[model samples]
Target: MIEVQGLTKQYRSVRAVDDLSFEVKPGKVTGFLGPNGAGKSTTMRMIVGLDEPTAGSALIHGTPYSKLKNPLRTIGCLLDAKAVHPNRSAAAHLKWMAQSNGIATSRVKEVLELVGLSDVAKKKAGGFSLGMGQRLGLASALLGDPEILILDEPVNGLDPEGIRWVRSLVRALAAEGRSVLISSHLLSEMALTADHLVVIGRGKLIADQPTYEFVKEHSASNVLVRTDFVPEFSQALENENVEFTSTHDEEGREQLLIRDQTTDYVGNLAYSVGVPLTELTLKRASLEDAFMDLTSDSVQYHAEALPGEDSDAS
Candidate 1:
């Protein structure tokens, strides 16, 4: 298990991570989510003792990373896939890491097969594709068969098959009672893989909860309805105190967006008002939508488009 308390990091005059506190428990995949400059990488660096924290502490199994005996065997990390030497073969890289940490050389081949990199183990890492490099990095991290795995963008350049493989691997590792903490910008992927989430914005914690609970609390639920009688529908909805917005369809029929109600309630209201409903459905917001809503203001870059502007105008 990993426990972070009052973690803070500052570079020059700017704060990168601010008073962050959270815990990653065993037997679960905890996703670390944030925008581009939200200090997620900084926090991960601090956890592994790659970067020093200005205040607070990050402990792995109740010991600081620098003070841990056999640190690599306790906490394995893939902070940067490109941190390896370009001239070395994948096997040579893992062999040296195993030697440095007194791990068995046979573990290198084991991790290679585990990550599906055995076929390319003899080839120089410089010639490998980004996806292949990621696999090699993962192989190195698993060399010690550590109890904790901290990966940053592990699936960034992987193809669909590779992505699925990583997801399954993470899940399988956690099922063995290992703690897995993954940092990624892919909300859809994280939603599928992570059991819990820790979201931060501008170096501050915005949410820390289960994946389902986070979505439920931050996303808005709405009802969608389609009808031909636009005037009657509006009047009925207004009378029932249902706030709605209308948009015309290709067939000139009206589609309403109803707020503060469920689809069943809207359907019953339409039935009571003698209006035939073509469609009545509930629209539950997705994790991507929730992420955008939560971090919209904290985004470092914003795209600008004027009203009625063409795509090429900007």
Candidate 2:
């Protein structure tokens, strides 16, 4: 298990990580989530000893990262897939890492096969595609056959198949009683891969809970209603003090997105008020929608449309 207690990092006046505390239990995948500049990478760096924490501690199996005699055998990480030498072959790269960490050279081949890079084992790291590079990085992480794995953006450039592979691999690893802490912005994939989440914002802990629980707490499911007597239904909703937003469908039909009310309630209300209802549906909050809502204010970076992104009809 990985435990971070009051992990804090300060760089001059800016606090990169606040007094954050959370535990990644064994046999589960804990997703680390935050917006850009939210101090997620900084916290991960501190956890693995890449950066010094101003205060608090990070422990793996009750021991600090620096205190581990055989660090690789205890923890494996892929914080930066591109940190390897560009000139070296994938095999050569893993071989050197294994040598440095006292891992067997035979284990390097095993990991290469595990990550499906055995076919391109001889290719230079620089020539590999982003997906291939990510695979190679994963190979290095598994070199030690550690019980703990920490991966950041493991599927950054992966295809659909590769993403599925990674998801299955992580779940299988956790099933074997290993601890997995993954950090990624791919909410849909993260929702499928991780059993739990550790959400941070502005360097502070925002949420730490199970996947569905977090969504249930941070997002609400709404009811969508469509009616032909739009003004009549609108007046009825207003009379009943029901909150709803109006939008137009592709066919120019008016639609009402009703919040804090169930479809049955809205449908019955329309029926009682003689409002001809064309449709009524429930729209549950997805993991992506919940993530956007929870971290909306925590987002520090915003960008406008790029060149040619907005084309004028005129």
Candidate 3:
């Protein structure tokens, strides 16, 4: 398990990670989510002791990472896949790491096979592709068979098959009772892989909840209804305090947005009011939509219109 309590990191006058606190338990995959420049990398660095926290602490299995004996044996992390020496072969890289920490050379080959890099273990890492580099990094992290795994953008440049492989590997690690904390900007991918989510914005914690609970609370699952009786449907919806948005249909019918709670209620209301319903479709917000709505204001960059496309120029 990993626990971050009141963690804060400051570089000069700017705070990169505010007082953030959260826990990543074993047997589950927890996704760390945030927009760009939201202190995610800084926070991960602090957790692994690469960057010291200005205040508070991060603990792996109840012990501070800095205080751990043979820290890599307790908590394996892949903060940067490109941190390896380019000239060294993947096998040689792991060999040096194992020798430095007194781990057997046999473990190096074990992890290489585990990460599916056994075929090119002797190839120089500089010539490897991004996906191959990521696999090598993962193999190094698993070298010690640690209890916890922390990965930052592990699938950043991976192809579809490589992405699937990483996802399955992380899930399998958690299933074996190891703690896994993965940070990514892809909400849809997280929705498919993570059981819980920790969201941050501007270095502050925005949400820490189960994946299902977060979506259920923040995403609106509404149904769209279209009918010809505009006046009657509008009156009925208003009387029932149902929140809705209106648009005109091609046939001049009224289109109504009905919240989940009022889906059946509105259908009954339309029938009682003698209004014929032409269409009713349920629309549930996806993880991507929920993430956008939550972090819209926290986005660091906004796209502007092209030079010829102005509001008044058109």
Candidate 4:
């Protein structure tokens, strides 16, 4: 297990990570999330001893990372896939890491196979594509068969198949009672892969909870209905004190977005009001929705919306 308490990092006048406290527990995949410039990378660096924290501590199995006698056997990380030497072959890279960590040379081959890089073991890392480099980095992370894993954008530049493979691999490792912490911008895949989430914004802790609970609390599911009697239905909804908004599609047909009500309730109300419905479906909120809602203010970079487009549009 990895425990962080009151962790902080200050660069001159800016605080990169401020009193961040969270735990990566065994038998589960904990997703570390934050917007750009939110200090996620800084916090991870402090946790792994890459950077000195200004305050507090990050402990792996009750020991600080710098104090670990066999760091690789206890924790493995892939913070940067391109950190390896450009001239080294995949096999040579893993072999050296294994030697440094007192791991068997045979284990290097095992991890290379596990990450599907055995076929390219003899190839220079500099020649590998982005996806192949990511695979090689994963192979090094697994070289020691560590009990804890920290992966930053492990699936970055991977194809759909490689993404799925990584999802399965981390989940399987967690199921074996190892702790896994992954940080990525892929919200959809994180929703599928992570059992829990640690959300931070602007170097402050925002949320720590189960994946389902986090989504349920931060996002709202709404019922969308399209009807012939738009006027009547709108009036009925107002009379029933149902919160709703009206919007038009590209073809200019009106639709009602009813919040705080289920599809069944909306359908029954439409039926009672003699409204003929063309569509009634629940629009469930995804992890992307929740992330956007929760971290809107924490995002340091903002992209201008297109003309006629609003943040709340649809």
User: Which candidate leads in TM-score?
Assistant: 4
What C-alpha lDDT, on a 0 to 100 scale, does residue 258 get in candidate 1? 86
Q: Write candidate 4's Cα lDDT for 49-163 as tens digits.
A: 9999999999999999999977999999999999989999999999999999899899988988899988899989999999999999898888889999999999999999999
Kindly report which residue stretches of model 2 are placed more than 4 angstroms away from their true locations once superposed: 271-276, 305-314
Q: Model 4: which ten-residue window has the lowest total lDDT?
A: 305-314
Residue 13 Cα positional deviation in candidate 3, in Å, after optimal superposition: 1.3
| Clashes in predicted model 1 | 0
- TM-scores for every predicted model: 0.94, 0.91, 0.88, 0.97
lDDT string, candidate 1, 250-287, tens digits: 78776888876888888888899899988888988778
- Which is superior by lDDT, 2 or 3? 2
Better of 2 and 3 by TM-score: 2
Give Cα distance to truth, residue 307, candidate 4, Å. 1.7
lDDT at residue 117 of model 2 (Cα atoms): 91
Prediction 1 global C-alpha lDDT: 0.90
Clashes of each: 0, 0, 0, 0
lDDT, candidate 4, residue 35? 92
lDDT of 1 at 109: 89
Show the colliding residue pairs in model 3.
none
Candidate 1 residue pairs in clash (backbone atoms < 3 Å): none
Q: What C-alpha lDDT, on a 0 to 100 scale, does residue 258 get in candidate 4?
A: 93
